[model samples]
Target: MLRAIVKQGLRASSRLAVNRNPDTSSYVQQLEAEWETAKPFSELPGPTRWQIFRGFQKGGQYHQLGMDEVMRLYRKQFGDICLIPGLFGMPSTIFTFNEATFQRIYRTEGQWPVREGAEPVLHYRKNRKDEFFKDCVGLFSNGPQWGKLRSAVNPVLMQHRNVAIYLKPMQRVNRQFINRIRELRDKDSAEVPADFLSTVNHLTFESVATVALDEELGLLREVNQPPGARKLFKNIEVFMDSFFILGMKPSIYKYFPTPTYKRFSQASDEIFDTCSMYVNKAIERIERKTAQGSTKDEKSVLEQLLQIDRKFAIVLAMDMLMGGVDTTSTAIVGLLLSLAKNPEKQQILRKEILGKLPSTDRDFSLEDMKSLPYLRAFIKESMRVYPVIIGNVRSAGTDVVLYGYRVPKGTHLLMVNSFLLKDEHLFPRAEEFLPERWLRQKDGNEDSANVLINNSLNPFVYLPFGFGPRMCVGKRIVDLELELTVANLVRNFHIEYDYPTETTFKTTFLYKPNFPLKFKFTDVKY
Candidate 1:
């Protein structure tokens, strides 16, 4: 219904007063205007105001007035890294958009608190907030609680170890991807769809499901988009929009989260519902153990989650749906497009792969991946060029100084990674995707080829997985999934961009290919 309204430009009165202010971008205008005469948020009884704000929260918009607004606000307010002596009573200081700042903000959490990230997150959590905040869920909680949960689960996800466990599933998904593309392209290998975004989504859907839920979608085998997968992608978009509006115009939609609000509210429920289904499946498996009085050793991550708390399981699952799905898919789309635009480099990398072990018949092991330095370099370059998450903001846990500005506590800090990736000073010929730049030369010779994100470079500058103790916990899972899937795809077939344009940028919120990409595969022969 809301989609119909949006498509048709249908009209209706806002259920709650929209913000009427002018300075707030149109995104926040309605809420800003609404705040003009609305009751002070603190004065609202119970959770009415909190609910309204949650219904319409839009944090991304606040970040995306471009970095200029973020910079100006940090400078104008308490200068940088200052206290949030406001009504919310939370400790926060906005940091300058730099690398050192990221290190200070994230590393200093022990002295301060990771709970600074919790309020907005917890407040927005609808059904599973309690469980998400409980003692054992590592990703969503803080302090001793986060420590315990992380300790239990971090082993499975500890950088390299987790990659070994799920390598086969990723390889399988990629082969499935190759098969699906062949089907989609009739006799003419040229018949492949111009856009690979949907294809990557289908691939990531299957990949993450295998690792996270021990389920498979075979979305590629179906040779059509998955219905829920399709909706799940859109739900992510809609929810981001809902959150952006809330940040832009907190007052406007706070009281009247209508129409758009309701659609997302429904989507939010659906997200939780989807998560619950997975959680329940894990729970049932755990319950079988409980029924027979078996020990926790007969458990997977999902089973362990069931033992700790189901609500947290549901939230983690939802986070995967929201976080895991789009990022991996969008990344691969950007990656293929990058190679398509740079055909010479693409061929070189393809030759490099074919020259190596050149077999996926056995389980594609991490060591196999380790052999493909160029493949690793190409993936790193793609991540640098088209990072799915440009940067996520951090509210300082306490007052800190950054870039000559006093960032007061509670001030919202926007970490601009897009700024760093594109900065010519840090990366000479920055726009050009040169994997060789990542390689370090020993003496004057092209000696040891290495792939590291330039250690001499500032830490806060580039954050694809985000920065701080509160950084993305599943970073390894995402890296492994992308590496295995993309390597397999490239190893099996050469990709050409059906369409290429430098100006193409799909969405403002997250980095995506500007348009649909079609690919032609030059079937590799060993």
Candidate 2:
């Protein structure tokens, strides 16, 4: 199909050229055909299609080979690029540790970078085509339709100015969350509950909801928390938890009513319905305001989206909610855990936070976030060590040479950034948590540390939010929430961990800490 498109395009171009030599035209056609059929997948070193089950250690399932282990083995066995035969129903996946190759693939990607669409999401939307998600298309979709949807929504969702609008509301949510944390912990005991992740999830949901729906859902409130909000949160967990089984593997669920599939379906339904309900209410609110002769240009993301396409707006809202709940909350957990384990770093961060903003009671404003550089550095360091998304997958948009091997067009390339970011060759004392590594000197000088980073380190290897045009859209929003939450916590109390934290990560869907994160928080003198 790609070949046909290229050939057709070449023929059309040839026709437009006047007085073209026949021989030159023939040569161009041959080159065009070659480019079209240039996929040389066999040249790449990768596991066979049937080796999915046996690729890893004995008794280890295909997807169960933790990303860390997978990267280590791949680097040891395969030099740069290695192919893993298509697992489940998906195509062969290419894992690369080569920074140059990663950059080449990203640079070659066209407007809509080819990638494997989320099979389970595609199936769900198709199944519910005539329902609430009839016009819903989001990040899960691929090709021209996905491109159109992304282009329409990116302006509204990806803008820094737009994302800044939610800061005050998010800070309000953070304050309520801090109060909730106070309720959950004791002054003497100072131990946070095991369900702290859930609390963070609520805070994230409330923040994203207020911005996305333009209505305060009051999810952080202890009493009278909306049932729909709880359902949405629970279902987001269900969807993410079930995604590994339903998303990575083939459609066994399509034939058999597996437990995972059922949960995925239920979660998808609840998410769509709940998001739709809020979207409709928001629309009604906008309508009421417009009816009262209000002429306001200020528009929430949802309102901006609705103006372009209503179904698209709802779908975007649903994606934002699910993404905010797990992905952002998981990072917050990792950041807090890291800070807890390193009291020295925590103290440094606290000093910066309190020194910049004396009052810890009020929420941080946009300007306040700018004043604390160490807080930003801390978050970056945490993400580098423990990224929420293990790898960013992109399909090769065109055939390219990777280490003298022919990488075919539309080939799935998994940039194993999580493992690469931790390579000792790239970062000195890679295992240690050093936010100062991200800090720069006040006077312009090529310090030893900065020199090493600039000369030796391939900056592309540390892509926590991905790269190029396809970068994560809500990155600014996540940064805002994380910085604010951490600033507030550090300002108010000192954080410490009770037990040694040996960071063991697992992947149910996304990479998250396998063990319970227990932190002891104590009030500090301000």
Candidate 3:
């Protein structure tokens, strides 16, 4: 089909050239020469179709391998550019590890960029019997529909002022999270449970809910917890687990509802219903507050979004709850592990934190957050070393050339950025946990301790939140939550992980922790 399109395009171009002026004809001839010289898409290096199919089977080479490891293997076998044949209703994907290719792809992605992953969620939303999401498909959607929603919510979510409104509320939640960590640790060991990721999940959920639902869920507190909060948290876990299975692996869930799809559908329904209930309650509260003229100085994220449209607000809230929890939790865990492993780095971060606040009891103001360059750099370095997502995936908005190959429009391009983020060429001493690498040099001079990353790093290679218009919508919220949590954590305790650091994360839709997180937290004296 693609070859037919190429041939048809060439014939049309040839016909138009006969009626063109000399300059136009020369330009057309030059374009044709470039196209003819470029290698065909089929000649791109990768596994054969049969190999890809068999490797994904029960006992094949790619079986049971995390997506991160598989991407690494592909790079090792096929070098920078590789073609992954389409299998089991999935589209053919092109994986590129070259930094220039990454830049070219983003440059051409134009307005209304099409990101083609999230098929399972898209299918569920489109085929719902109730048609609940017929109008607003939220962030996972593409083209005009995604653009509309993104534009509507940008004022409430994307702006620094709007996102800063949640700082105080989120700080309260962070305080509770710090206290919960103290309570959860063993008295003798001063270490949290092996399943410490669950605790971090609660913190992320509570933080997101504080902004999204305009109320505290009390998830991190020991007593007086909301009854539905636990159930909502569990349902989100099930939703993420099922999404990983359906999204990453090959299956016939779209034709006939598989067990995983069934679980996914049920979890989706429950999550939507619960979020709807909370949002509706928030609507009523806002209405009453408006009626009595008793609103606060700052509005919650939900309230600001509701002014746009109710249904849009509900869908956006649900998307936030679903997308925010697992990704942020994984990131928090990764950052904590990075700090725990490098005790010297952790101490440096603590000194930075203490110089600003002097006490854990004080809340983090916006000004204080801006001043902590090391804390910000530490987060960036941690994510560089341990990115939560494998890479960014996008479909070609139009026909384009990539790495001397003619890639047709609609081909799914997976920018395998994980390899580039840690590559020695892109980052100096990439393997080491050095926060100073991201810190900007002062007095127009470079020091041995600090690596000037701006001169060496490609802007496109280190995309933790992604790039351009289709980037993560909740990036601001996630950044604030992470910064607040890490600051309060370093100021309050000495984080330590007394174990060998080997194989820490596995890619399950998102890169999640593979092993137990038993981090020891000794109280720090100010």
Candidate 4:
């Protein structure tokens, strides 16, 4: 019956065409037939293909605005969840901000759940099998490969005790960064340089590399920094920027040698080469210690990972270095920007830091960080307002019901936390940054701010680090970096933006500030 209808549609379409190919006529007929049958997806309101196509023609506004525009337009018209048409008249992608539905899907996500990044890696491995990705699979792979990688690394990277091994190294990098900030500030204006993002990137790269590879790249040092470190930083940035473009857009890069694909390939080589160099060094060091019978009780992340699989260790380190640097720095930028905008909150945090870290030279132990509740609250509040990653995506592993609609398996699900965070019912005065909202009472009473907020806010809505098994593995490291740096900065100086810096949404595989952040730094009086 369906074939008969398709044949009739093809006949009708063929009649109107001046000179259409068989393939084109057949595709049009199929699309028309599918359009008639797929009423459930169409019932969910979204912009028409013409509307999206018109925006695409108007100087690439569709690509520039990207998912943010989709979430905004559909959520306004269709409430929490709606269908969003894809580029080039592709099937509609599901846009959801419903927390209950998200929880249901995530909790039931199977062992081989599909994720957002599998396609790009699969393409890379297929094309560069001999050159770049010969030995290992990427972290974002699905099915058995993803399960294997996750299980091997989780025991070492995700544990609290194993992660705490990097505290002293992070402290050293933090101190170097603070000192670098002191040098970068002007004497008269008392403001740091406008190119603060570069500094933050350098710091985060140094810290993550130290922990992930067990090598001192000395990226924070003003003099005699490793040449490979500088190259690695630039390459990682290029890799991230190009990955987003190639992954999101309908480009000829996949089939032809486009400029973006060329850049991505080159950056991938540089990143892999740099990580291999460091991994080999780390392995040699461990071999020497073992041969000499030098028994150290606790091993670094690289060592623990090497015990599982050497190639796995190298590839995971590359992922950590390549993927972690920009994101961790972006979070720091968000935290500092949030505090800089609100001086009173900055002072409150400064008092907490000063009380805990009395001397500038003293390092913040894991215990010390755990004691500072206000500092933790401040970081959480900053992330809540300006998330480093805008939202989460899951390709449904099975046919699931979301928001009363039976969404089919393999449909793309984009949960827009940016929309969820701004809902006034979930968060009172949602636009304002109130760190106290995340605070808890110390009087052993039930009326704590955190308790109240927890009661009111749905558990699924506040996933800054994501949720369940697929949550970020480097979350603990990011936490240590933020707390230590914020503590040390507050201990030494009072943070305030010299001018009103406008926050614009920019994308480089993740959301980051598009403008310069010039912060005024006044020395604190004890």
For each candidate in the order shown, give its overall lDDT on alpha carbons. Answer: 0.58, 0.73, 0.83, 0.74
* Model 3 vs truth, CA RMSD: 7.2
What's each prediction's TM-score?
Answer: 0.73, 0.87, 0.92, 0.87
The best-first sequence of candidates by TM-score reads: 3, 2, 4, 1
Stretches of model 4 off by over 4 angstroms after superposition: 1-39, 47-54, 60-63, 77-79, 85-92, 131-135, 442-454
Candidate 4's residue-wise lDDT over 399-462, tens digit each?
Answer: 6666666677788877777667777778776787887777766676543464446455778888
Compute the lDDT of residue 498 as modeled in candidate 3. 90
Model 1 C-alpha lDDT per residue in residues 91-170, reported as the tens digit of each score: 33333446666665554333223543333334445334445333334355554455444444444455465566566666
How close is each model in CA RMSD to the real structure?
13.4, 6.4, 7.2, 11.7
lDDT of 2: 0.73
Q: Write the per-residue lDDT of candidate 3 for residues 1-526, one digit (tens) a residue.
A: 3233324534443444333323355644654566688989878999887998799899999998988888889999998899988766877789998988887677666556788878989999999999988877888898766766676676688899986789989999998888899899999999999998888999999998988888889888888878788878888899889988887777789889999999999988888888888998998998899899999898888988777677877788778888999999889989999889999999999999999999776898999999999999999989988888888888876566788888877889999888777777667677888887777666654532345364656789889998877788899999999999999999999999998769888886588887878999999985
Model 3 stretches astray by more than 4 angstroms: 1-36, 443-456
Compose the digit string of candidate 2's lDDT tens values, residues 414-475: 77667677777787777888887787754564332463244467768888777755677788
- Weakest 10 consecutive residues, lDDT, candidate 2? 14-23
Superior by lDDT: candidate 2 or candidate 3: 3
Who is ahead in TM-score, 3 or 4? 3
Candidate achieving higher TM-score, 1 or 3: 3
C-alpha lDDT of residue 350 in model 3: 92
Q: Number of the top candidate by TM-score? A: 3
